[model samples]
Target chain A: MGSATPVDDEAALIAQLRAGDESAYEQVVRTYGGRLLAVTRRIVGSEEDARDIVQDAFLNAFKSVGRFEGNSKLSTWLHRIAVNAALMKLRTRKRKPEQSIETMLPSFLEDGHHEERFKSWDEPVDKALERAETRQLVRAKIDELPDGYRTVLVLRDIEGLDTEETAKMLGLSVNATKIRLHRARQALRTMLAPHFAASGGGKATP
Target chain B: MKCRELADFLMDYVSGELPEEHRAHFELHLSRCRNCHEYLAQYESTVKAGRIACGEMSDELPGDVPEDLVKAVLAARKLDPAK
Candidate 1:
């Protein structure tokens, strides 16, 4: 596979892909396959299906390479294609069982006050997040979120998609997408609370 | 603004999407409430942690393509070269 060149010089790569250059396709695959796999796997929650989705994305990109404009960075374009492929795969399948995030969300009192006090972490937030265990816990909590909320969070947060684009991908209203993203973050925070308790010294109660 | 109101608006406020009309009230409440302060900090941290976790930190790939996947795609392309 050819090494990936800088995006500013990607016109040559684009030209090669447009001409159905085998090496260009190989370079694209080698460069983007793993990132696409991670995204697809997060969305579909299955390694086998995610692999197939990645393949479909590559094939589709190859077929449409002739039409790709240089307006966006090549990586962004490929990421969108991979996300669309994952969303399509999700649409075709029977819905998998998804856990509810309600219990993980915060509770409120009758007077509109919070039912619980959120303690400041004993350690600096950045320092705490740098630990491998903390990162693993975060990923696990994200996986536990219900499908709707998880998809919104993944697309809007991790994938850095705009709200409108996320809604379009998931067939959701913009309002619904925003709400889900908020609740998903809130639920994740609730899940990490004990791990960062002021008294616990950044222990893992999870 | 009440705590529940701030809770609902935290995401928008943090993203700077909250309307200027509501920003003052939101900030005013956030300043006075210890619980909301902690909640907001925790919420922001969770967002950052998840991004780092799912992004480059945890989703790293081997530099070379997987042989099986690359071979399968190459074979498929050869069989249907016209497209």
Candidate 2:
């Protein structure tokens, strides 16, 4: 049903894998390696560690392939494996206490109005982000988020996974996922405000 | 809706998770409230900027993956008992 590889093809590949075909293993690696590495890198925050995690995920998937009854697409299964591998790496890394998100949230007056009004960001964010410098700034800002918030943002906003799937992946409830995602977005907006904000509430002409 | 009320549930509206009645009310408020409308645009811009940042991350993949990674995995496969 409208997939990159046909169901018959996937079935044949799974059969070949189950039969211990070496080429099938190579095919899986070649097909999924780039994307799996990208997903892991965002979570683990290091390209080298991401590579190691992808290798581990592939190995883990191979060991468990027989149990993979094709209830979901192979890529979906592989994506989950990569996510888990990154999480495992995160757990093993030296834990640092994350900074609280309260400091990054927008402030409202007692009367329910913004303490400081946001200036109209006249330049579309996409246009601003198209500049290499702004793109780098955005990435750095994302990295500044606490891991919990950052992971939720990456899964929901970046990877385009639905909230329920993202929640399940993180072992968080849907509500928690939404909360973290919203906070992450808010924090990111705070980080981005300086660049976008006009000094006196006028549009910052790009 | 007041600014505080809209701020409290902004994420729900953006995510399309608010019920139809709530969504209609939220939209009506946006139509009448300039401040909330701008805040909503900023919130949406944050999400857009985040996705663009992520796209850049995926775009930075090396042309060739590390050979060691593939070699190590394949070598380990040869050690598997099932094979």
Candidate 3:
């Protein structure tokens, strides 16, 4: 999607990549590197690790270029590799402590009502998010989510992967994936409530 | 339906997977409850904002991808056995 190759030009690019043309490698890196970095960074939740993961993903892509059937867009292929690399890193780094998703989830009163009243954002959320600070806050809150929830949020919500695909990737059932995604979205909503609520979160950035 | 029960179906509700039989019942609760309606609207907004925030990096070049990182990947291709 990002500039490496339009579907029309993808076959030519794949041939060049397969031929190991130095310029082709350079083009591929320049085209997709930033995008891949973005994908991996969110998943691993670390700048340094994301960089390493992208590098590994690129190396792996080159090694397997011959095997690529061109059945998918070049960006999609690279995206998958980057995602897999990030998930693999996550699996290996399981020793790190993760927060419980329960703490971030919504709390219901005895009558099944919200403990806190819901307030609309100071402005339209999409427009308000135009502020870089607000976006950062959102990213930080997302990173704050426990790995299980964060990954589900990233893949299903951000990456736009299907529920079934996400479930298969995470080795969970579709129902389980949906549950995690819901909890993740709920947790993020709670975390961002203060920042966007009409109580003056709009001025936080301005 | 109580706000909690309605909230419970949010996952399906948002995804449009909530059963047809339950949809009317769900809307009835939303139409009657200001709290639940706001909650659903805000919840949907949250999803949109979250996607935009995370996807912003990839759309903008050099957002966070350092110049050196690109060079390093290219250099690695030569020294590594990928060729």
Candidate 4:
């Protein structure tokens, strides 16, 4: 709970929010809008669309505030709504030919050995990602995943939703969610290997 | 567990979902096998790096989110009756 408000205070705020206090609405937006929009932007990959999704999410939350159980943090609840809104937009969009993940997966030989050698990236990944450029690269590689796998990974790994919640959101079975998430991480690792395995540690000059 | 078997169990191992016996086997394999250990570390790194990137992305709010989002959402709120 990164929220500054005490639990009782948040409960009161939720009451006010449900009662249609305009100020409460503004307060909710001011507090959670940026974070929600950022999540939607990652899922939808567009600022305008992300803004629209956040708007829809807030409107949905406002309309449904009575149902907000307070079992979770308000920010997390809002984050879920935003993720739903983004997924809705994704569903309604025109279909593109789906990208195959085969290219991104690692190749294995007939004898069950890796087709290529993997160099040890003994450096801590958190340290490597701390570099602004490496973080950008990480994001780009995640985006390269196919939508199904990418969404699963984003929800399960990045958004920190449990496998069950992710499966529920994606209309997938728990086993399917697990498989998709594993494949997504493996593919992402393949994409990141060159940069991390390089002796230079992907350090940015600037 | 062999390396190929360990590959299939990687997710379970990392997520702590593997059964105790399987986990022991997986750990034992990692202890002796350099390749599997490196692979496991990189797999963990992929997840760690992904989470970090997403956390950074969440901190990055585009320009429209502050004032415009609030205004638009409030307007929507006004039109709909609160439940």
- Candidate 2 Cα outliers beyond 4 Å, as residue runs: A1-8, A197-206, B56-58, B61-64
TM-score of chain B of each: 0.85, 0.68, 0.83, 0.78
Pairs clashing in candidate 4?
A: none
lDDT of 1 by residue, A55-92 (tens): 87788778887778879888888889988888877777
Docking class of 3: medium
Q: Judged by DockQ relative to the true structure, which candidate is superior, 1 or 2?
A: 1
DockQ per model, Cα: 0.57, 0.49, 0.58, 0.55
**For model 2, how does the per-residue alpha-carbon lDDT over A1-206 read when each residue is reduced to its tens digit?**
11113234888998888898998887777666766777688798998899888987888899889999799899789888899878878877897888899977877677766665667786898888778788778878888889999999988887788999999888899989998999999888888887877653432222
- Worst 10-residue lDDT window for candidate 4 chain A reads A197-206
Global lDDT of each model?
0.80, 0.79, 0.82, 0.80
Against the correct fold, how does model 2 do in TM-score?
A: 0.86
Local accuracy of candidate 3 as per-residue lDDT tens digits, B1-83? 78788989998999899999989999999999877887798789889988888774423443334679878988888888565
Interface RMSD of each: 2.7, 4.9, 3.2, 3.8
Q: Tell me the TM-score of each prediction against the true structure.
A: 0.90, 0.86, 0.91, 0.88
Local accuracy of candidate 4 as per-residue lDDT tens digits, B1-83: 66778888999989888999899998998899777787888999899898888773433532234666677888887787665
Give the 10-residue window scoring lowest on summed lDDT in candidate 1 chain A.
A197-206
**Candidate 2 docking classification:** acceptable
DockQ, candidate no. 2: 0.49
What pairs collide in candidate 1? none
Each prediction's number of clashing residue pairs: 0, 0, 0, 0
TM-score ranking of the models: 3, 1, 4, 2
